[model samples]
Target: MKPAILFSFTIFISAFLLFFVQPLAGRMLLPTFGGSAIVWNASMMFFQALLLLGYIYAHFSIKRLGAKNQSKLHIALMIAAAVFLPLSIAPEAPQWDASPALFVIQTLLVSIGLPFFVLSASAPMLQSWYFSSDAPDAEDPYWLYVASNIGSLLALLTYPFLIEPFLSINEQKWVWTGGYALLVLSVFGASFFVKKAPAAEVTATAQTSSSWAERGLWTLLAFVPSSALLGYTAHITTDISAIPLFWVVPLALYMLSFVIVFARRQWIPSSVWVWLAFAALVPSAYAILLALLEPVGLLLGIQLFSLFTLSVAFHAILVDRKPSASNLTDFYVWMSVGGMLGGVFNTLVAPAIFDRMYELPITLALAFLLLSMHLPRPKFEPPSVSIGKAVRAKGMQTAFSVLVLATAAVGFVTYMQSVDEVFEFTNTMLLIGILTPFALWFVHPILAGFAAATVCMVLPMGYQHQNILMQMRSPYAIHEVREFSSSVGQFHSLYHGRIQHGVQATHPELSRLPLSYYHTSSPIGEVMAIREDFYDVTPVAVLGLGIGTMATYVRPGMEMTFFEIDPQIEKIARDAEYFTYLERCGEQCKVVLGDARLSLQEQPKGKYGLLVLDAYSSDAVPVHLLSKEAIELYMSLLRPGGYMLFHVSNRYVNVRQIVVNTAAELGYVSYFQDHWPRETKLEELMVNSSEWVMVGRNKKDLELQIFDPRWEEQEPDGRPAWTDDWANLWVYMAW
Candidate 1:
């Protein structure tokens, strides 16, 4: 094969393997971390840091070693990395008791670190090698970057849609390992081509002429988009589910930006993209405030589009400022450094310092600053009267600034008056807020960007602050217990990110009633009530302990075990100040703190009469708990005719089919109950709609009168059963 084709193939395959491993590995670790979106962010940071190391290696090799020697060393490293392949987490992988973020990083490093590092280096190293070759395309090796991004885009898009749905996790890992071996051969072949026709020597002056400022500009350009990717990702996933498919959207768009910006013929012109980005900034800023109020699909579209425009605009600037081939590696090294810094800030620093998601605004402001720097200075055809025009412009700028400040002040005051009151005018205020930033752009782009960011970040925070009684940030999630007053009564709610996990009425009389999803009229409640009739002093095991709400069902002499993954959540739920569910139950309940799947494994067989899996945060359901292996485990812990109940209630995903399919595979009968309560005074006591799936060993066990018409026996409809090996949340997305 020709050198150009060989080089392109190597870059493509390397990127394919690199991106493929990301979602694959993240999916594997999801259950371990309780399916928090933070896992994806932490994974992204680890991969980016490794990419930087890989780039540093590539840069050092080209500068310090001869072509033949560099090729030989890289090949040897590839072989060494291959030894760690067929990747699987070690048996002693850190448990939830350890610092989850630190453990996740350590696990990735031990499992796939070396192989990923080698793949990360492949694109830059191959390009450098090609630049030193006699191939006609060597001088302009940048197009290979477009190829690399395309391959990356393909991997990300395919994983959720095709690869994940069809292949088991182990199967995916082996396929990637096989691809890595082939990539090694391709690299060797390309190296042979390089040896036959080597690059001409570069002058010392050519290597040292580039200024530090130029490098800094490159780093800044790369930094804004890289950081924005994670910021946008967290913002979206926090509100929606933290499934791999949602994670894929922002990343795929980020890669698409590179493909468009670095292509030989630009898909979107720089001039057009600059304006598109500016226009997008307003709506994106407005959308932040509307994340909870608006439909998720619309909000998601706004965020993703904003991310795409900003990325393209910044990346275009990076491409335009590219240095000659002699300085290519240096340019990439700085770019990698910027990317790494962005990941570090988004994954590590922001979560540590900020109470809320302040990274989005910070990144937006920085993106605007970089964009302003890159845009051409506004031209003014000689003014008719320079002094008068300048005076008018100054006056307008002052008026606009005052208006913006006054709007912010009013919004803040209204928020302080009542948090729920702010939502009444949020849409109107958001529109004005969106326009204010665009108007300020003409007066001062820097201030405009920051003002836009402040509107997006600070105003929403003000609203959150009003009703939030307590807020805590853990590596797993941002937890908030908020208070709301309605006609029914005042209620205290537990929120994981923006999704309300559990709610309890503040009135002493109503405090014991399960409010959200688990209300007496709901499916899970019906099942629990039926179990009471069938078994005296029934033993129950609840997978999630959100506010310990399920403890309300504990009667005298009844035994209940609560398994929760997040220690912070357990602490909050057990605290009588925040919730009384646990305290109200007296000695009937016990709490087990760990990943429910791992913790459940230690339980005695035939122990519980009913098992309830109510562990869901927003739509961020722990997939591991829903897998075939988990079902079997739950079955093992239950008595012969014992039933298992799953809370499949979610805004984004309909998990009824997944539950039905998994149950059928084990010859267990399944019944789905979807409850939509009326808007009457009594019904208002319940927070929202509920969906539950109950599985039993014998069909007669689920033949209770309450489970008759409402609890329909569902057919799988050819949907693949979810197992520890394979599952895709995308397959069950309600949208």
Candidate 2:
């Protein structure tokens, strides 16, 4: 068989096996990590970094060796890496409360490290090697490059459909182990062609080694797109329900872009997609803003699709510019550097630098700049333009500018007026939507894409039901909004994931009443009303005030303090007037701002019968809150034998297991309750639903009294409670 054909097929299988394992391993860790974007990004960073090291190693190691020596080294490494096969690594489950970034990096290193490094570099290493030895007439390893990407794309698409539902986490791990073994054998067979002779003479290739400048360019091209993909994923998941398979679509589309860009036949040229990407950027940004401003479900979905399409287009542009086969290893190594750089930027840097969603726009601008740099340099010939055409172009430009400013103004007004009752938002958005087409007329498609996207951003904020109840933007975000439907006198409230971690009912009456988690069915409600001669509501401190759902538990004279991360949620609730938990509860609802866990640490010692922690309204619970240190803080704020209610309802994992394990470690008597409130009442104007709460109490007479029919008396074999240092996600992956 021809060397290139064999080489391409070999690399294809290796790439397929390599990427197939990524999502599988990521899925296995999801329940414990809560499917946070950080988990995926951080893991990618580790893989990329390791791949970068491999490429550098291969580039340096192969330079002095003959073709035969290269084969020997490749086989030896592949065989050495095979020891990790049957792919079992120690410490299978992760401790949920540990630093996810650190934990993901550490875990991936031990379990899949050697094999993953070998796999990640195989495509580039083999391509470069074949180009050097079997060179005279072989096709540019670039076509074979397309095959590698196609394999990656197929692997990503296959996992969610073929692997996830059919197999349990351990089963998937074992399945991948079998594939890894086969991949090694295939790679070994392909190594024989390394020393094959070429049939025809050829043109000169790029230098076998990459220079510093070339490496720098590779880093630039790679880092930005990687960061952009990660940032977009993070932005979406932070505000929406974090369901399973969220990252798969984005990554699958990203890999598919390679099929379009690098294939032997061009399906979509770089020119058309570059224009599409440009067109998409402004609108995508605007759509996200509209989704954020108005809080509409359909709008958010549209925004996500738009962003995904544009991100794929942008990444495809990078694949089009990849280095020649001679520098293939160096190219991938730098790409890994870029991936690492992007990871650091998104996970650690952006959060610390920006307070709002500024990273989205910054990334858009960065993507635009990179595209602009890649455009062919203009000719030095004299510029030519008809007088009439120039005039028309100038007029169009002015009109486009006018429309953008006008739309931006409309957007600013909507955002500012979101907290004001007198402003008619729907009327404003209607006007903006009407003015949209005029902005696009006579404008370039790229610019028009921005304008159209801006239109999407501006028009949605004025929709009638866009009543955002609560929005908070902190290091840890939480945005809880309520959509009002007076037809049934119902209000629908949703927890906007991390964007709004804690909620203070902005509604006047509902502010003090425990509404969300503290509704009538929860153990907190029973304990508050019946007190059972055991608990009361005096001097109550609630860690997370989600829609002020727990405020209903507060009596006329009770003092309730709410700690919230986002101020926007508080402002929205104040203006919406629909949620009355705070309004009806009187002057006793005091809203505290900052991280709830940190806020609790600062509060003075106080004796309270009820210390409610309603932090887990959504599935993505803050890791810090579940730690041993955090439990101690909750205990510190409670009086002896105080009834502490924790909200534990989630769609992602069995929350009761973690809470049960946590409570057992702390020696607190804990009980679980399933609270699935009717969706109708949650949407009604006045009907407030309660959360299913798990109640835990301090020991009586220095003895742990395990009660409540919902719990089992068995202890957890003394597994230590999660602390900042010892927490790992693998601990909870047993689910």
Candidate 3:
């Protein structure tokens, strides 16, 4: 076989394994961290840091060692890395009460760190080896980078579509191990070809000098896009489930940018990208403005397209400034450094410093600034009598700045005065605010970009500040206790991201009533009513403790246990200031703090007469709780005739089918109802739609009139039952 073919094949295999392992490992760890989007973000940070280290290792090995020595050392390291394969999280995983972000990083390092580091280092290392060889394609070995990203793109696309739907986590692990063995052989073969080539010759014309400014520019170009990737991924996943399908789409586009920009012929022209960058800012701003109000599909499409255009435009500039082969590793090392900085800021710094998602707008502005630097400066006449032109430009810049600030100020004041009304007008002001940056581009792009970002940051925050009574960020999610007032009365609500988890009336008499989706007419209400009728004193277990709203149904002498993952949530529920459900129940309600699945495992079997699964209503469902293993665990905790109720309502995922199929696999009789409150009094009561599925061992136990005629027995769909081994969220995505 030809050396070029062998080298390209090796690079492809390494790239495929590197990306495939990322999502697979994230899936395995999802349940441990309550299926938080932060899990993926933190994991991305770890991988980026490792990639930087790998580049450093490659740089030192090639520059410091002879070809024969480099080959022997790398081959030995590859074999060493294989020892840690068949990857899985460590046995002593962090408890939910502990620091989840720190533990996620720890777990990834121990389980897949060595293998990933070796794979990451191989691309640059092998490419350097190929360049030193006398292969016909050696002069332009960078084409191999395009091959590597193709493999990366294919791996990311295939995981959610093909591998995840078909294989279990354990199965994926073994397959990956086998692939690593093949990569090792391929690397060894490529090294043999390199060893057989003519001795290395040093090029006297190799460019070795690069200014600090050039390096800084490379870093900035890499930084903005990497930050934008995480910001957009988090934005989408927080609205939908934190599944591989959503995580991979933006990343695949990111990898495609590298492939497109670094190609022999650019896919999109430089001039086109500049205009595309400017055009994208409007929709990007619009998307941010309407993020909470717009449909998830439309918002995601706008942000993703904006991400692609901006990334391509900036990365093309990076490619244009690429140095000769002699400085290949140096260029990549700095690029990786920039990428790592972005990850650090997004994953580690932003969440701590900002209350909201400020990273998105900030990164977008930086993209504009970077692109503007590369754009041809608009020619201006000398200061000589052309002070007129300069004066006009300054005037326009000041006017545009005033326009942006005024728009933000008015939008904030409007939202504050009529927080419940003026949705259309506020959205309009925001759209105008985002577009205001484009007008400043002709005067100065940097100033324009900053003004645009300032508008994006301040406007939404004004509304959020007026509505939110208290806000807290956890490793799992951002939690807010909010208040709203209407003609009916004042209402207090709990929100996880944009999803309303629970609501309560502020009127002392009405505070005890279960509001929102838990209204007396909702499916959960019906289930609780049936339980009350059947048993004199029902012992209940609730999976989620959203302000302890379900405690309203517990009569005196009836015992209830609540499992809450986030400590802040538990604190809020127990606080009398937020809601009185838990406080009202007093000793009758007990809260267990930790992951429900693990916490429940420690409890005695068949203790609870009723089990309510309310954990699915948050930003992302804790998928482990919906798996066959989890269902069986819940069944074990319930008495033979006890009911297991799952709240499967979601904006993006249709979890109804998953519940029905899993129930069938367990041989449990399952019934489902889509309950919507009567519209006659909905506005006055603030009732919302809910879907609940009830499962039990004895069919006769569930035969009650409270189960409305509309409630039907759930039937199986053709999709495979979700198990601890395999589950595909794409099968259920509403889009």
TM-scores for the candidates: 0.88, 0.65, 0.88
Best by TM-score: 1
Candidate 1, superposed: residue stretches over 4 Å from native: 27-45, 92-110, 195-201, 209-212, 240-244, 267-272, 289-292, 295-298, 381-433, 441-444, 450-470, 530-534, 575-578, 616-618, 700-718, 728-735
Runs off by more than 4 Å, candidate 3 = 30-45, 88-110, 195-203, 209-213, 237-244, 267-272, 286-292, 295-298, 380-436, 453-470, 485-487, 530-537, 703-711, 732-735
Stretches off by above 4 angstroms in model 2 are: 1-5, 20-44, 64-68, 88-108, 133-137, 158-170, 196-218, 240-242, 292-305, 372-512, 521-524, 527-687, 690-735
lDDT of 1 by residue, 1-735 (tens): 888788888999999999899878877776555454445666777888888899989888877784567899999999999889898876563565667667788989998998999898877788888887789867777778887888898987887788887888999999998999999999989888665232325644344546999999889888889999988888788765455357777888899899988888876678778778867867786556544536767777778899999988888878888987767788899988888888888878887887667788778866666565554444445657688887787788769776976775665466446557567675455456567756676666666666666665555565555677987776677789988877788888899766677888888999989878888787767766764556542788998888988888887888898988677888888778878898888788899876788788878999998899876535555688888888999999988778888887766777777888988988888888878887676456746788888888877766663356887887667877788778877877877
lDDT (10s digit) by residue, model 2, range 251-288: 66666665666677777777666655655555455555
Task: Summarize candidate 3's per-residue lDDT along 428-513 as a digit string, tens digits.
Answer: 77566666666566566666656666555555565455677987776566678889987788999988767787899999988878
- Write down the worst ten-residue block by lDDT for model 2: 196-205
What residue pairs are clashing in model 3? none
Against the correct fold, how does model 2 do in TM-score? 0.65
What is the model-wide C-alpha lDDT for candidate 1?
0.78
